[model samples]
Target: MVEGNNSEATKFILLGLIQSPELQALLFGIFLVIYLINVIGNLGLIILIYIISLLHTPMYFFLSNPAFVDLCYTSSVTPNTLVNFLQEVKRIALPACATQLCCFIIFVVCEVYMLSVMTNDRYAAISNPLLYTVIMNRRVCIQMVVSTYLYGFSVGLLQTMLTFHLSFCIINHFCDDIPLVGLACHKTHYKDIKEVILFTLAGFNTLFSLFIILISYIFIVFAILRINSAEGRQKAFSTCASHLTSITIFYGIIIFMYMQPKTRHSLNTDKIASVFYIVVPPRLNPLIYSLRNPEVKNALKRIIEKVFSTVK
Candidate 1:
């Protein structure tokens, strides 16, 4: 992202997904619906969790943060994409693009590690139920959530600033180049530092967070196996079902999308994969919790009934 080496393209035109007008229109409609659903579902769950007195435990407390992160994650990317679907040139102004990239990175990093934090919370609950409350008190939960954000901010800001500062244009562009840094439209210059910084950030963030999540789940699995009662074991597993599903879905898509060697993958596939990866997870997070967890289901029913009674 260094200066003076790249063309002074004030705007980068995204080679939007499909060149066909008809396909573009169809995609526009489809994504618009998905965006709306994502917003409503994630926000609805966060509101419900906060409103329901019965859902005030450490688990729900952690759940609410992820719900909000999901909402923020959706907001960060979906609207701009929806706009791109209908545009003629798919142009994003320089400053606007920088802002979008920053927000996207922040939420993405927060979410990757937040899943591990939740896993640790689950391990404590399953393995040390007697001290779960004390282990995850109000202050501790807030600190954990805050640290996730702070870590996200540091990783995102540094990568954004460093990567964006380096120039990434030219005929022989590296595979791991920045997502929308005018690479398609301009041919400038490049260096080894560019690859180093990008790889370092991506590798460090993914591996560190992944290590924490795997370790926590290992303890969790060992604890679950030791429970003598079959029902107790099932209940413990059920508690982690939602988070595990989220981790599996998101990490599977994202890791495949980002961590691959750029040359082996097609840009078109990358675009489509990223679109689904970003949009689907947020939309599904709440639904997973609501459908799988009895508490969320009960709270939703109770709220609906109370609303109906009021209306009547």
Candidate 2:
């Protein structure tokens, strides 16, 4: 193994999801479909929110950020993965790997923070419907969105900086189970620090976001229960149910992908989990939001009708 240096030999081989040519072809086709859906769905949601005046609200405002982030998240991982499936060498240059690591962390962090903000938005709506608008005002919503991006960028920058400073072997492969920090340090002495940083960034961030989301939902549930009318309670819950479903699918897979002990993961299982972690959430977010939320559904119909009219 060669030490990490900025030379012609600084590339690493990526084994990809599978080694067999037949399996690679099958995986590529599946991933291509998933990637296209992720792109269209996320882009459609963002455009739909922007053009539709009726959908302009703090909740949907927060919703737009996730669509944007998920668009970026899937783009970072899926395209490279697709290319790798078709490659004979399966080797990734050091620069490309670094870029992937940077983008992957940034989007992952953005997703967690944005979901937490969505839960908080829900909490505001349920806990005080009268004051929901006031509490989740334009200014507060903007700040929350800004904070999510800043936090995501900060974590990505730190991890990237940490990795690039240290030396690494020439042939290391990119693995979702391993963090950039873990990839850098080859010595046993640094293993403790490496594990700590990896766990702190991947595990702590997710759990922390989940804690905030969980707390917000607890209050949301209490508020719904206190509503005098069954219709009122259902109305309140309908707003949050979509976000809750999204949170469940996203966080569940991400936790399994990054947080669980390595011994628990098998080779095939790991690849499948990673695919769902990176690709499935983005592809699913638009469908979940549109199907569950009335405003988005109506906005989509308007969009389609307008497009057909223009074509006619």
Candidate 3:
């Protein structure tokens, strides 16, 4: 419990997911597979979107950024987690912990808003199919994408600055705001401020984005209902199916992890929930999008055929 004049603890030990040696090896293997899938799936989605001209719509344009962000988001945490699983002492320096926290905030915020924007895209396309092109024009899409990343970076910087200023007595679990606050030394003003900042920032980001998603989907549901033909209704819903699945899994886990009272949270449960949000979503999103969306599926088939022909 050492403290300096202006510095918190320089290094904090991370108590990883499990303690048993045998289970550690098994979990390590499982997470390795999960991490690899996350990487390949996300990268494949990005590359597929880029090379396939058919996917060059506002929907896929919005889709690609999440793929990129998920790739980065999982990488920032999962690899370190893998190494820690194998190590005797899973210690992380304050700077590295800060970096992980920064990246986590940046991508989580990006993911939150990106889901909202994608929902809006769906609403625009479904509610006004004739003018979908004009509504989601290239300039407008570009602005939306830029704003998502900008907000993410801004929040990341603000949160990181506030968090690292506090003196931590000890730290365990992965580098996340709630757990970090729990382990921080009981410095009244700094602790209070950090908790408030966490609540405000996380609450606003989640709720604001969720509000947009809710309103957009309500309109989308009505729009689909208005279509006279059953075929027309199905076609409209098919477009949004993948995005909706993504939003469900993502937001469900986020709310479960963060929106609860502190008394209700256990570090072990938080660790498992963290895996679902961080590692699982990246792998699942690509599958959800590619499997459900016809455009992406067709493009993937074309690419596979082309590659096999080239080999022959």
Candidate 4:
């Protein structure tokens, strides 16, 4: 039901992850748990950041953006994926599938830039602590966030336009960009060019964001090394440690999944990669920050105590 001249298919049969009923049942339970945790952890972090004034610094402000993105990003895929595990023919309406792909592009782009912005925030906080407040004022923080969202929206719209032009006579997997391109009924004239453009957009964005992160972290490492006190150095590294871990896991999986040309990509392998890429980051991000970050932990503790006292 895509309102385009190119779309031929009305619905896509999502051959969800695997065909094994037994494995599907098992994966259903596993992913249900993961989705719940992803929801609670991310929403909790967002609410905590909103309510707790102590965490109103530039770091937490940037942190909350990713949490919100993770929540929406996972929601766009996981519920439908979970349902696909229960039924044999996992058919998604063309409109819904198109919406899924658009949302995926939007949030993934937002997340990539959000991570970059966070690194910049960390660089400012550690490299110039005295001027941190001046450097990341409220207006500047809002502008950076607004810019990230705007860029993401633009890319999502552009990519969605390009993708929906394909006449999907047959769809053999989830409504992801890679799988859709791979399984699209490539009888159209622009198929090859479109695929090239799609991959180029993905690859270019990945490298561009990675370049920003790499340069920011390099400056961060030098600034941390210059600190004389061992405690000062540890504190500085600690601030970035959670972000560093999250990025390593995120970028490592993303690079493995998307960097390959479509010919080299095995759908089976890509499906596994998709699970890790989609599920793991949202689940682990909040845990990494909450468990490792003193501020988040203290804020949670205070909120818990207040709730208990009010109940008593």
Candidate 5:
């Protein structure tokens, strides 16, 4: 008999997305398709951006970063989630779990800031067309990219260090306790503190980014409305529509996931929200931009024609 505190339930089975076997199989298949699409779509966007000289603009520059971020974001979780679905053992190594958490946090934070940067880029283009180039020069754009990544990495590091410092007692179980930090702990003072910190960081990052976007759009909308020509208003709104769609999807899920009380923790809910960030965004981003942005569409067509001609 294993003697330890009740909290010593070392290895907690994930129950893998759902408890029903048939549902598990179906869900796995669905997610597998989604993951594949996400990979291909994001990769295609990146490749298209690189090859398409016409897409060499500040907006596309910001768009490409998120596409890259989405690839890394989805890869961090979906692959492991797929593996867990297929196997009897759904255990993760302690180090691996920590790494996943860190990477996930990093990319998520980066994406949030990158979206904000994109908003600023749009603001410059729409609100100050004359100075857009001067304001968003190559150096400034590169700085924004670097700042986003560095900020994300720093926050992720701080959270990882804070989380992994807690001790987990051993228990009688087939699985290792270290691997499941969420389940392995009997009690730790830092859990609530760490969670609060994480939530605060997420809130500040998301809300701050969102505030900037909203403010920029408010000015953009004002500028569009002042234009005597209907065509000008339509054009202005059209330019922002795709970014707005992406912003809504991204921040809506983020708010739903992070803005709740700590007592509301549920693995199923977490996994679903995670899917929005990891799977849906990546798959939908290219489609959204390509459908809405004329430049991306033309560039894609040109690239496709060039490739076909080369093959011939």
Candidate 6:
């Protein structure tokens, strides 16, 4: 039975993106721009998808979901981090810290599973083109989405519970207030174990999903190569290029951060990597998908034209 300290620490101060004032200002500006772009781009994608009946296909369907998830993903971290940069003291309460951590974990896990589902969608389109509609129908799509959220939420609950359950007795300083690794102040030997579990879950989900994507692409590439017509091969390759680019960027940063030795787990490094997952990917995903997709571009153009015409 863990005893409660009613007089326990309430809040924690977050060391923003960087400690240097110049760097903080610079980073704040950069991230602000990125956040704006992320929100605009993703929101545009969602709107375009909804308004344009032509983009009701499975690919666009999955793309829009990730765009939404990415928006939430970036929101979970960037806003708070940005605010902390401006404030003299960036303090968060214990409940807020727990909430942030849980939210962050949930969105990230969702992104991972969503990417996997997107890869599978692509695989079906390429490998079983004739039955793509039947295989990835609305029911199936809904199930995939539901499962992704369920898996993410369940994993997040487990991790957050395990992490906060430990007693923070050893450190006299603020344990509850610090976000991320700051929660480790408890004389908990479970830090290593917790990290291992997190790494295992994230790593397994990412690597396994990546493996499926790779295998699917292998088959897809083979199919494309077998196509005698240049146009057919070109179309197939073009369809996959955007997904490949997004996946590479997403997993590249994740693997780089997690696959490293425990010795490399610095707070600054982790924060930077977290920025990649939270800020950069969300900003880039909509651009990548929209720029590559003709239907989306056309819809966006129409929407912009209508907005300008209305203002006039």
TM-score of each: 0.90, 0.91, 0.95, 0.94, 0.88, 0.89
Q: Mind giving the per-residue lDDT tens digits that candidate 6 earns over 46-117?
A: 988988898998988998899888888777767777887677766776676667777777888788878888
Task: Quote the positional error of residue 23 for candidate 5 in Å.
Answer: 3.2
The residue-by-residue lDDT of candidate 4 on 235-296, one tens digit each, is 99999999999999999988988897666897788778877888999999999999999999
Residue-pair clashes per candidate: 6, 1, 0, 0, 0, 2
> Which sections of candidate 6 miss by over 4 Å?
1-7, 166-179, 307-312
Scored by CA lDDT, what does every candidate get? 0.78, 0.80, 0.89, 0.88, 0.76, 0.76
Name the best candidate (by TM-score): 3
Q: How accurate is candidate 2 locally (lDDT)?
A: 0.80
* Segments of candidate 3 deviating more than 4 angstroms: 4-8
Tens-digit lDDT track of model 3 for 10-94 = 7888877778889999999999999999999999999999989888989899999999999999998888889989998888888
Model with the higher TM-score, candidate 1 or 4 = 4
Model 3: number of backbone collisions: 0
TM-score, predicted candidate 6 vs. hidden true structure: 0.89
The order of the candidates by lDDT, greatest first, is 3, 4, 2, 1, 6, 5
Which segments of model 1 are wrong by more than 4 Å?
Answer: 1-7, 167-177, 181-191
Query: After TM-score superposition, what is the CA distance of residue 23 in candidate 6 from its true location, in Å?
Result: 4.0
Cα lDDT tens digits, model 5, 15-103, are 45565768778878988999999888889998888877777877788889999998998888788788777777566655666687788
Residue runs of model 4 more than 4 Å from their true location after superposition: 1-7, 187-189
Q: Give the Å shift of residue 135 in candidate 5.
A: 1.3
Query: RMSD for each model, in Å, please?
Result: 3.5, 2.5, 1.6, 2.4, 4.1, 3.6
Model 1: weakest 10-residue lDDT segment is 168-177
